[model samples]
Target: MLTKTKAYALKGLEGQAVEIEVDLTPGVPAMEMVGLPDAVVKESKDRVRSAIINSGFDYPIKRITINFAPAETKKEGAIFDLPVAIGILSAYDQIPTNCQDGYVLLGELSLDGSLRKINGLMAILISGLQNGYKKYIVPKENQAEASFVDGIEVYPASNLSEVVNHLSNVSPIPRLETKKFNGKNETSKYGVDFADVKGQLKAKRALEIAVAGGHNVLMVGPPGAGKTMLAKCVLTIMPDLSFEEAVEVTKIHSVAGVLDASQGIVTSRPFRSPHHSITVPALIGGDRRAKPGEVSLAHNGVLFLDEVPEYGRTVLDSLRQPLEDGVVTISRVLQTVEYPACFTLIGSMNPCPCGNYGSKNKECTCSPSQIRNYIGRISGPFLDRIDIQIEVDGISFGEFKDKASGEPSEKIRERVVKVREIERERFKGSKTRTNSEMTNEDIKKYCEVDRESQNLLELSFAKLGLSARAGFRILRVARTIADLEGSDSIKVEHIAEAIQYRSLDKKYWK
Candidate 1:
């Protein structure tokens, strides 16, 4: 007898269909699993056998060959355990063969006839729906994650016996209900806000611009200047993530297995602050299985690197590709995977070794060579990717003791949301959601400046010794600055404000 069941295999966030074929022939009673399965998939046979017997089902004593069709690609994970077990029972007269049609089964079967939750359930279901399959059988523990995806009927089962009972028409599980996402309602309120921070109005403005346009920022300041505190507030001023953006961000976290199963979705934008001691592979993504790194995990959100210079030179430089390309490709001999890495980078570093190289009150202790070596740790090419570079000086005790907050994050967020609406309408059909993502063609079409702004940019270019890339970055930032004030054209004041952000490198990098 022969039976076939439907399953799925995941490569990155994409789902490929796999047909599990079960053949029961008259020979020595043994089972074999083919089609390039890894360690976890190979171990499912023992689990299947024990689960079937424990669930009060007689194990088939025949030469059973479980062949995962399309035997070319390698399959990983234990997500195929349920389908393989179902195929064996259906091959015999125990379960009806016609019952498993049109449904994609995904679960890891335990030794005692229970089903366990597997990783990447959300991606698998999305891929299944994309491949024209609507019905799914997933673990009960993944019910919350499965509830968010609409247009499908997902039946959550707790054990192998429950799945067998459903297929046998003895009992059936209820379909999962779709949950509506209201980012405003679901968004977690942050404890710290812009109101809590003391001073540094210029730094606050720079952060607002960065968040408004999705640009990267670098803060060069001494210790106790609230660089870290200011970075946390970036999310507060930024608008909530739309439904489409939340799905993209959730897919990466689901595949990386870092998702909060109870929450079932990423309501707020991610703020990932990886330690400085992280390796290049861990930060950029690569291992035995090309998993998502910090950059990919921070997609549609912020990637905060506190004490950016404290990170290794190689690790810091690895961000160059993701920063420019908006994606990281991990290539191995077996296969390769690309993960999205579009994020706003917020980096902080000290001015020198003593953290007071340019302090006005404190006397300079580090020599010129020491200052050069300290700032030189960040390469020129790497620093070029950062669009905003501002120096945050220390504030006096009087500023900290003012007791009155200047501007609340809510007022700042209102302006940011309006700017985002402008960009969405400006680039309605394209992939760009902000001015910073403009290409040369986008720059030419949208960022044309008048004669006064043109002469100001030209003078800054020659006087500051700016590279061609640096000049274009200044133009992108200028476009964002103009958009903040609802200006239709890039004016002189916008260009001048953008120019000052580029001169901080000469102050320290030189």
Candidate 2:
């Protein structure tokens, strides 16, 4: 007799259907598995055999063969353990075969017949639901994560006996109800507020523009100049993620296995600060499994690279593709997987190796070549992608002593939310959500400049030697600036502010 059961395999973030087929014949006693099973899948035979016998089921001493259909596709992970065990039991008349239809099973089986939670269950459940699979049998631990998806009847089993008994109708298990996700907004209110910063109002303004537009920014300054503090404060002003964006970010983190089990949805935007010594593969995501990297983990959020010049050139440059395409593609011998990498890049660096190249009070200790080499580690192409580059100067003693509080982050966030609302209305029925994501077509259609602003941009472009890409970015930034001011069209002041941001590349890199 032969019995088949449905299962799933994860290929990167996506899921593929796998059919487990078990056969029992009257012959010599043995068990075999086929169909390109990896070491983990192939080793399921021992676990299945032990679990079946330990669970008080008749371990058939006859020739038993199991074949995973779609033999050409490579199946990995221990998620197949439960399905293989159930298939063998059903084939041997331990459970009814008709009971397994219209359901997908995924879980790792312990030797004692206990079910263990497997990684990537959320992605598998979402894929199954999208493919019209209404029923799922998962480990008990994954119940909350799997319940996040609606319109599915989930059965969380703890052991092989419970599953077998439930399927056989000897003891029926109740279907797990879909968790009611209230879909309420849970934005954070406590964080580093911009009002705490003493001075450097210019840098604060630049950060506001960056946050409003979803633009990337780089801050250069001496130590203790509020560069790092300002970067931390930007999170307070960022717009809250929509439900769709939350889903996208949550899916990525779920696949990366970094999601907090208590909070199923990633409510607050992520802020990833990887170390300077991070490898290229670790930064961009590539191992034997090709998992999502830090950038993908920062999707719909921020990737702050502090001490930017200290990082390896290769590792820093590896972000170019994801920066431009909003997705990272990892090509391996077996497959190519693309992960979302759309994120706001906020970076900080010292003026020189000694951190005081152009300081007003301190004398620089590093030589000219040292300064050049330190800044040269970052490539021009990467710098060009950054929309705003501001030099953060040290606050004077008197300014630091001032007791008057500056504008609070809540006030600034209100403006940012309003600006984002303008963008949302402008890009209605389109894919663009922020100024940074606007294409050349969008710039021409929506980011048009007046005669005075056009002349200012052209002269600045000639003097700055800006590329077409930079020019478009400037237009986008100018558009964002105008939106922040509640202006309908780009003005000369907006162009000037946008041009000021491009000065750092000329002052440092040129």
Candidate 3:
């Protein structure tokens, strides 16, 4: 007897359909799994064997051959365990073969016949739905993840026996209700607020512009200048994630096995702070399985790198491509995968090795060469990508002891949300949601400058020795500053403030 069941496989965020083919014939009792399976898929044969007998179903005593169609593509996970088991029972006449049709089966079966949750369930279901397949049998633990995907009949089962009974019409399983994507309640409120920071009004203004435009920022300061604290508060003023953004984030987290099972969906913008010593693969996304790195995980959110100069030269330079393209491509011998890496980068570093290069109260101890080499750790091209650069100074003793707090994040977020709304109206039919994402054509169209601003920019370009890339970045930042003030066009002051952000490399990197 021959039985065929349907399953799904993932390559990055994309999914491909796989057909599980089970064949039974009279011979010595044994099982074989074929079709380019990896370690996890190859071991499913043993798991399926134990699950069938433990579920109170008679184990087939005939030679069983299970094949995954599309033999050239590699299968990588234990998600095929349930489908292979169901195919065996159907081929042996335990359950009607017709019952498994039109339904996608996905889950990992334990030795005791209970089902376990697997990663990337949301992506598989979305892929199946897009390909005109609907009804699904998934693990009960994954019911929350499946609930968010609409237009599908999802039957979540607990153990192998429940799935067997459902197929046999003995006891039918209940289908999960469709869940609506909620964006309002999904935003997380952190314990630290922007109002907790004291002094550094200039640094606060720079961060406001950064968040309003979705631009990258680099802060140079002493050890206790509150640079890291400012980075944490950026999220508080960030606009909430929309429904579509949340789904994209959820899919990445689900595939990476980092999604909280209870949350079902990611509600807030992600804030990932990876250590500086991270390797290239771990920071950019590659391993034996080619999973997503920290960049992809921070998609649609912030990637905060504290002490930016402490990172290796290779690691810092690897971010150039992803920062420019907004995507990272991982290529393996068998397959290639692309993960979304669109994010706002906020990096911080001290002035020099002694952290007092430009301090007002403390004298510099490090030699000129040591300070030069320390700042040189961050390459020129890497620094060019950062739009806003500011120096944060240590607060005075009286300023720290003052009772007054800085502007709250809620107030800053109100202005930010308003700026984003204006941007939304400006780029209604386009893919860009912020000023930093504007292309060359977008700059010519929306980022137009007045005659005065144009001459000012030209003079700054000549005197500052700025690259063409730096000039475009200045225009983008000026455009964002204009948007924050509800101006119709870029003014001279906007261009001047924007030019100020680009002159930091001369002070530090040079």
Candidate 4:
């Protein structure tokens, strides 16, 4: 007898349908698997067998063969264990074949016959729904995450017996109740807030603009300055995640196996601060499993690299492509997978090895050669990508002891949300979301400046020796500043303020 069961496979963030086919014949007792399965999938045969026998079922000891259809695509993980076991049981007439039809099975089977929760269930179920698969049999442990997905009948099974009983109509498992998606149900607090930081109002203002326009920022300061604190406070002032953004972020986190399954969704904007010793693949996404790296994991959020100059030049340079394209593609011998990496970059760096090369209150000890070499670690081209670069000076004693708190993050977030709404209305029915994501065409169409602003920008470009990319970034930032002030056109003052952010390259890099 031959039987088939439906399953799903994950490749990067997308899921593909896989048909688990089982064939049993009255011959020698042996079992074999085919269809480009990985070692984990191949090992599922023993697990499936043990689970079936241990679950009070007769194991088919005859010649058995299993294949994952669409053999060209490589199948990985133990997501197929339940489906393979079901196919075998259905083929042997132990369970009605009609029960296995029209359902997608996804879980890992233990020797004790219990169903273990698997990663990427959210991605798989969402993809299956889009492909017109309605019903699913998932592990009970995944119920919370599965509940977030609507328009489908999800049967949460604790073990193979429960599923079999439910399918046989002896005892039917209740379908999971769908939960409504509320992106802002969870509070948007990150413990650290801008009000806690005593000074460096300029740095705080720059961070607000960076988060408002989704532009990259680089902060230069001496040791003990509030650069790191300012960067950490960025999440507090960021706009709330839309339902679509939350879903996209949740899918990536689910596939990476880093999601908090209890929450069933990610509402807060992600803040990923990788160490300086990170490798290229670790930051850019490529390993044996081709999992998502820090960039992809930081999708729709902030990717902060503290002490940026302490990082390897190569690793820092590796981010150029993803920074420009907003997506990282990891290629293997057989396939290439792309993960969305649209994130705001926040980098903090010291002026020199001594951390006081250009501080007004501190004396510098590093020589010119040493300062040049230290700053040289960050390439000019890489600095060009950053839209805002501000120097964070040491706070004065009077300012630190004033006991007056700065503006709260809640107020900053209100302005950010309003600015983001304006962008959304401007980019309606399109993919562009923020000023940083605008292309040259978008810049020409929306970022036009008056004669005085244009001439000022041209003069600044000539005097500062700015690259074309740098000039365009300044224009993008100016557009964001105008949007913040509710101005219809980019004003000369906005252009001047945006130009001030680019002066650090001349001050430090020279």
TM-score of each: 0.96, 0.94, 0.97, 0.97
Global local distance difference test of model 1: 0.86
Q: What residue pairs clash in candidate 4, if any at all? A: none
lDDT (C-alpha, whole model) for all candidates = 0.86, 0.85, 0.88, 0.88
Instruction: Give the clashing pairs for model 2.
Output: none
Could you give me the TM-score of model 1 versus the true structure? Answer: 0.96
**Could you tell me the TM-score of candidate 4?**
0.97
Q: In terms of TM-score, which candidate is stronger, 2 or 4?
A: 4
Model 2, 58-134: lDDT tens per residue? 99888988888777554674788898888888888878766788889888888899998777777888888888898
Candidate 2 has an lDDT of: 0.85
**Cα-based RMSD of the predictions, in order?**
1.6, 2.1, 1.6, 1.6
Residue-level lDDT of model 4, residues 304-324, one tens digit each, is 999998889899998988898
lDDT of 3 by residue, 422-476 (tens): 8889889998878988999999999888899889989987888788888899999
**Candidate 4, overall lDDT?**
0.88
Name the lDDT value of residue 432 in candidate 1.
77
Candidate ordering by lDDT (highest first): 3, 4, 1, 2
